[model samples]
Target: MSAGRDDDAQGAGAPGDAARPKVSSVLFLCGMNAIRSPIAEALARSLLPPTVYIASAGVRHGERDPFVDAVLEERGLSLGEREPQRYEDLEDGFFDLIVTMAPEAHHAALDATGTASVQVEFWPMPDPSVVTGSRDQILDAYRDLLGRIEQRIRQRFEA
Candidate 1:
């Protein structure tokens, strides 16, 4: 296990627990790929096993947020190579799990998974873009958003 990891945060499955199945592919979605979904994707990339194929998208296409790049830089994470993509842009739209961070994304994921066996989880995250304040305050909002998504990712995948 990596240093500073706490397995008890979410009561994740114990070692050798047969009840939890390994997740192969996952999709993270939000209203825009600018902030939430991409951050979640980067967090998952750092935490989850490489065997898991992880990708993120928005309900509609959006430009990458520089605040996202700046905040993630504080964690030594980068999104330099990732271009924002919409659900319709995914070449392989199939995934074992679709994690949505916004209401619109949740509904879209539901519609996309109709008649399919995929699992859809709604996380209902806040959009930090709506926040207006000083430079520190704005960065704080992004940091808070990053923390929330990081916690959720750790809870669901860490053990």
Candidate 2:
């Protein structure tokens, strides 16, 4: 969710009112980094300022999905040559927020961060890979997922 500051009792910017801590780094997590999490990471990187660090990881490493690449290309975004990474493979383990799009990822994040001050949020996104149909219908499912992720990123990060 969007990080917000509480106004001072006196006024909006009264003296001695410390601003709330902003989310400087975020991790988008899912069962497989191939789709949802990667999409979120790319969108957040594009939407948020450069000062905000964004990354994505999965509970287990998965092969990159071509559908993800196709949909991202439609929006002028790309993951480049990046491959899906597992949570344990992350180069940097610290983040201000860890947004899990899958139930498994949420559980894993909570378990991994037990007793740590990290914030974890479960977003409950559906897996587009589960949609079996014609090529057009499958692409539509991916597109729908892409739209949902974009909307969520805007709601949670953009002013």
On TM-score, the candidate that comes out on top is: 1
Q: Which parts of model 1 are misplaced by more than 4 Å?
A: 1-20
lDDT of 2 by residue, 49-103 (tens): 9999999999997999999999999999999999999998998999987888888
lDDT of 1 by residue, 30-78 (tens): 9978899999999899889889999999999799898999999999999
* Candidates' C-alpha lDDT: 0.82, 0.81
Record all residue pairs in model 1 with backbone atoms less than 3 Å apart, i.e. clashing.
none
Model 2: runs farther than 4 Å from truth? 1-20
For every candidate structure, what is the RMSD over all alpha carbons to the true structure, in angstroms? 6.8, 6.7
Query: Candidate 1 clash total?
Result: 0
- TM-score per candidate, chains pooled: 0.87, 0.86
Q: How displaced is residue 38 in candidate 2, in Å?
A: 0.4
